[model samples]
Target chain A: MIIVETKNLSKVYNPDTVPVHALRDVNITIEKGEFTSIVGPSGSGKTTLLNMLGGLDKPTSGEVMVNGEKITGMKDSRLIDFRLKNIGFVFQHYNLIPVFTARENVSFIMLLQNRDKNEMMKRTDALLEQVGLGDRKDARPKEMSGGQQQRVAVARALASEPKFILADEPTANLDSNSAMNLLDIMERMNREEGVTFIFSTHDQRVIDRARRVIKMVDGAIAEDTLISVEAANQ
Target chain B: MKTLLTIAWRNIWRHPARSGVLIAAVVAGLWAGVVTVGVLNGMMDQRLNNLIESELTHIQVHHPEFLDEGYSRLFIEKVDEIAAFLKQDERVKAFTKRTITDGMLQSPVKTSGVRIRGIDSESETRTTNFHTNMMEGEYLDSSIPNAVIIGRTMANEHNMELGHRVVLTFEDVSNQLTSSAFNIVGIFESAGTDFDRRNVFVRSSDISSILYDKAVFHEIAIMLHDEPFAQSLAADINQNFSGITAQTWRELSPELNLIVEFGEVMLYLIMLIIMAALAFGILNTMLMALFERMREIGMLISIGMSRTRVFLMIMLEAIVLTLTGAAAGILLAIFSIRYLSSAGVNLERFAAGIAELGWDHMIYPIMSTPEYVTVVIMVIVITLLASLYPAAKAIRINPLEAAKDS
Candidate 1:
């Protein structure tokens, strides 16, 4: 079943003076358990599409229906609530609170939800261990490496128990080894837990690992293609 | 709220040196303001106390016509009855009747106009304690005929001394001129040089014998244990007596009262000025804090922290900064006030300005509990007001743009 769908989504920046078409008439859908990557060259609307899909930016013209509910028309305040409850985001940089420890960072979303303390702690510990930073739970963002901090961000994104996560170039700042390890862990989580993820990236490594790749040109989708297991292995 | 405070509290320490400097500035500002105002308040209090003790008693009564310059038109009727009434009133701690007249005071070589007060010496001493401040000879030896006590300034200006007889010329009640040679039996020096020069005291019986057809008085000065009740007592006296005007110390010395009130206004003004300076320091620091953490703030909002919560967090940060600093400052001030109040700050070095103003050369810093509490409350209020600018700046930021700032 499709967990996310967008219909004819468009976004324009500085529309009155110097209109920049960031996204145009984008139509896309992602199903549960799919590992998707939205890929494009520079200034090709990949990140804008992700932003529209995540409800961080309102589309100038069209609908973003996640789980069959239109979120594009929601107020900014209600959009925040919707994002907190039903969606997660991982930015290019780690974006972990510099003052919060790794475990606290992971637990922040649950804290926003005002969840039970013991339950939140248990889930946070499990998420940290799953990200392979179990022993580094007390480490602050500044005290951790780029890869470690991104893992913390991932754990944070998952803490709200959202239906899907949108990662915007999650490994852009990582070294090659850290990038591979982070992609491997995300892929494993996608396969084992059926946690849907759609990320925007220019990285070929991320595009190679995605079960499906959506390519963009200018501001609209140019190609949407699925990779078979055998073809992906080849 | 807990989440907001946690973030705020931690954010303050993110740059310990910067936050510490802000706190230190707050501490130093409050300390200087409180101590300076306290010392000024002490000086004003001393000035008032000296005025009341050495000269103006708490309440004074005069025949309405008697406030003019010469003794010819000034004399209170029914003096014995008024004196009897004052002696019976429990609120009247002490009272003295004076027969006052402006006259030419003739020394051996020079002459000066003076206000001659005919006083029952013992009663005058009880009312003003001028006897204690007498610097030479004796306080009106009634045994010596026509004995007089002159102030130091008048004695110095005239080159007069003890046992030097000066002829005083004035108008009697019949409008006839009279003169008498009264021996200077004592000399007294007081805080006010002008007051010392203008006033000279003589035995009431001696002057009244020549000036009045019957026993009478020009004024009645009343002292009280509760100085604040002076106005009420004066009102009572005025109402009870048909032809007299009873005035409180404040009414008699309006300019002095104005100066004391102005001193109070100056205390608040000082607080406002200090707070204004400190407010800018805090605003600059907190704004810098918010600017530096724009990405983090954007991340928080993007993840769903409400703008109200963000606003509250920034405000909490400002409050913590001010409260911490002001509390430390007030504590430090309390300690120093206690020490300086007991040990006293000697202003003999500022004798020309302070001592010449008729206050003692030493001042004890004075801040009552209510005043200290007022200072603390004012600081907290000013800090809350100061936070509005920075908190609005924090909340007005667009998360999308801020997150993209990189």
Candidate 2:
């Protein structure tokens, strides 16, 4: 089923004095359990598109429907609630709260949802183990390595059981081995749990791992290609 | 709410040094405010006590015309009846009658105008404890014939000592000038230099004999067990008596009444000024903390923390910070006031200057419980006001922009 769709989406920065077009009439569809990557160079609207899809920023024009609800013009308070229940985000810099432990960082989204203590603990422990950071649950972000912190971020994104996770250059700060290790865990989760993920990146390895790739140039889509639908099913 | 509070509490300690400095500023501000008000309260209390105990008793009675016209003929009528009533009243601690007349005292070298109070020596002492203030010699001894007691200020000014004789001249009840010779048997000192210089005491029989063959009384002063009952009792006296009027100490001294009323307003004004300063310090600190945590706050917003929750968290942080310091400061002030009250803050070094203003040399600091409660409520209000701008700034942060900036 189509879980996310965008039509004629556009964004303009400083539209009054010195307008800069960040996205122009973008259209895309994302299916359930799909591992899709949007690849582009600097200022090619990859991050802006991800922001629009996550409902973090308002589109200048057109509709972004997530799970059948038009979110482009939703009020900020209502949009925040929608995002909490439907979408999760992982940033390039591993944005786990520094003051919170690895387990607290992962369980924070559940806390925001007001989950029961027993359920939150059970799911938090299971998600941490899936991300391969079960032993590092008590450690803070500052105490963990860059790779470990990023894995905890992924676990946090999944804590809410969102329909899809939007990752913005998730491996941009990791080493080559750590990048591969992160991709391996994400791939396993996508296959085993039928979790959907959409990524915006410039990394060739992430692009290589994606089952479907959409390349963009200068705020508009240049190409859309399906690398392997059979491998994604297995 | 619990998680929000936890976050707020931990956020304050993110920069321990900065938080510590702000807390210290709050402590100092509150401490200074409380101490300054306490000292003023102490001075005002002492001044009121000195007036009530040493001079004006709780209530005073006089002929209706005596206060308006200080003539010797306007002495109170039916003095025996009033004295009899006061003696049987349970509220009356002590009472004294005096024959007062404005007169001139002639020393060996200089002459000065004085108000002569002729009193029954034993009752006068019982009512005002006037003999406790004697600096030298006896207190209006009846055996000495024309004995007199003069204040220290008056004796110093006239260069008179114990046993020196002086002549007093005043108009008699029939409007004739009468003169009498009296020897100074005592010299006393009081807090008020003006009162000391203007007043002298002599035996009632001596002055009454010269004024009229029949006894007369000009004033009746009553000391009550509780001063708060003075107004009601004075009202009762006015309703029951004829040809006489009774006045409480407050009515007799309007200036003291004004001081007592305005002193509370002054205390609040002082507290407001200090709290305003403290509010600025807290505002600056909270704003700085907000700027430093912009990225973290943006992340929280992106993850679905409601704006109301974010606002509550920020406000809670400020309240916690301010109340912690305020609690410490109030405890310190209370203990300090109690200690100094017992020991007395002595100003003997400025005795001459203070005495000239009718104030005692020692003061005991005092603060009521309601005053402390007011201070606490003021601090909370100030903290809320100070936290507003910063919390608004926190919620206005755009998560999209913050994500890119980070």
Candidate 3:
């Protein structure tokens, strides 16, 4: 069953002069449990495409239907509520609030959703352990390694138990080993919890790990490929 | 809300030097506000008290006709009945009846036209500082048929001594010329320069004698236990008596009343300027912080914190800053005012200016409960106003752009 779908979504920036085509005529559909990568070269609108899919940015013209709701036409506030309830985001920079500890960063989304304190704590602790950062929960982003911070960000992204997660270059700042570890952790969550993971990345390692890959050029999809069982099992 | 306050408080301490500078600015603004208000309030209080203690009692009762041309008219009849009525009122602390006449007091060297207040000296001593402030000799002995007490200026001008006789003359109630010889008994000095230079204290009987008629007092003065109660008491007295007017001390001294009025105006003006500075200061700080933390704010919005909550968090920071500053300001004000209250700023050097302004030269820094309470309220108001600019900026902050700031 399709959990997320975008139809002919396009985003245009600086339309009148020196116009930049950020997204153009993008069509994509993701099943309930899938690890997908929107892969492209620099400035190929991969992040913009992911932003559109996650309901973070509305398409200039077209529709983003997530969980059967046309999110593209929703008000900013209702869209925010949709995002909080059905989607989670992990950014390239980890984007943890500098003032909060790793555990607090994970708990912030649930808190904003006005979840009960005990439930929030339980989810935060569970997600932190799932990301293998149970011991580093008290450390601030600045006090943690790039991999540790990214793991905390991922833990935070999962704390709300959203149907899908949007990670924009989740391991772009880490070393090869840390990157591999983060990808492995995300893949494990995708397989075990049936949580769909959508990532935009320029890194080939992320493309290699994705169950499906969509390659983009300029602002439109150039190619879409489905990974066989052989590739996933490898 | 708890998270916002926690983050705001930690953010304040994140850069101790910056916070310190802002806090210092707050402290200085508060101190200046407190001291300015304190000294002005003190001067006003002194002026008010001196006016009440030195001249007008809380209320005065007199025949309505006496208020019109009564100074020169010599219309002192029915004084005993009025005094008896006022004395019976429970709220009346002390009351005095006095005959006042515009007359010429002449000595061998000088003759000055004076407004003579003829009093029963013993009752006046209880109600006013008349006897205590007398600079020489003694108060008029009413039993002495022609005894008088003059002002120090009068004594200095005429070089008169105790037992010296001054000729006091006025018109009789029947509109006939009359005169009397009174022995100089005492001399007094106070804030009233005109009064000291020209006024003479004569027994009521002497004034009656000078008028050559059975006499009554032109006015009655009533003292009260508290200054604030004076106005209400005066109103009650005025309402109860149909043919009389009760004049509170504030009404009697328009010049002194200006000090109180001026203090209120100056306080508001100072608060406005300080609020402007505080708003700018807080906005400048918050904007700088927002500029630097744009990415963080965008990230929070992306994580589903509403734009309204984001704005509220920033506003919370501003409130925290101001409230902290206000706390510092109040402490500084209390400490400084208490200190000023002790050493008391001496404006005696500005004696001429003080005299021209009709304020006492010595200013005792005064803080009434209401005035101090007002400062606290001002601090809160200023802080709330200061938060507006920062909160507006935070609300307008674009989540997409802010998240991309890095």
Q: List candidate 3 stretches off by more than 4 Å.
A: A229-234, B65-70, B104-113, B130-132, B135-137, B141-187, B192-195, B225-245, B255-259, B355-358
Q: Over the stretch B1-406, how does candidate 1's per-residue lDDT look in tens digits? A: 7777787788888999999999999999999999998888888887787788766889888888676555555677767777888888888889888888888899878988888888887888789877777899998855999998898878989999998999998888877889999999999977667777888889888888889766668889999988888988898888888887889989889988997898889789999999999999888998899888888888878887778888898899999988889999999988988898988889879765654456777898888898889899899888888899988988877767533737
lDDT for each residue of candidate 2 in B1-406, tens digit (9 for 90 to 100)? 7887777777788788898888888888888889778878998988888787876889999998888888888898879998888888888999999898999999987899999999998888788876778899988865999899999999999999998999999999988999999999999998878889999999888888888888888999999999889998899888879999999998889998888987788788999999989999989999998887787777778877777778888899998888888998898889888987888889999999999998878888898999999999999999999999998988898877446655
Model 2 agreement with the true structure over A10-59: per-residue lDDT tens digits: 99999999998999999999999989999999999999999999998888
In model 2, the Cα lDDT at residue A93 comes to 82
Task: TM-score each candidate.
Answer: 0.92, 0.92, 0.90
Question: After superposition, which runs of candidate 1 have C-alpha atoms over 4 Å from their true positions?
Answer: A228-234, B69-73, B87-90, B129-132, B135-145, B160-165, B175-177
DockQ-based class of model 1: medium
lDDT of 3 by residue, A1-234 (tens): 898998888999988887788988988899999898999898999988888877777778989899888899899888777888898888988888888899988998888888999999998998999989989989998899999999998998898888899999888889999999999899899889888999999888998889899999999999999997478668
For candidate 1, the per-residue lDDT at A171 reads 89
| Interface C-alpha RMSD per candidate, 1 decimal | 1.5, 1.3, 1.7
In the predicted model 1, the residue pairs found to clash are none
lDDT of 3 by residue, B121-235 (tens): 7888778765666887777853566888887767888989888998987776777667778888777766556567778888876686566546667778889877678788878
Pairs of residues at least 3 apart in sequence or in different chains that clash in candidate 2: none
Please identify which of the two predictions, 1 or 3, would achieve the higher lDDT against the true structure.
1
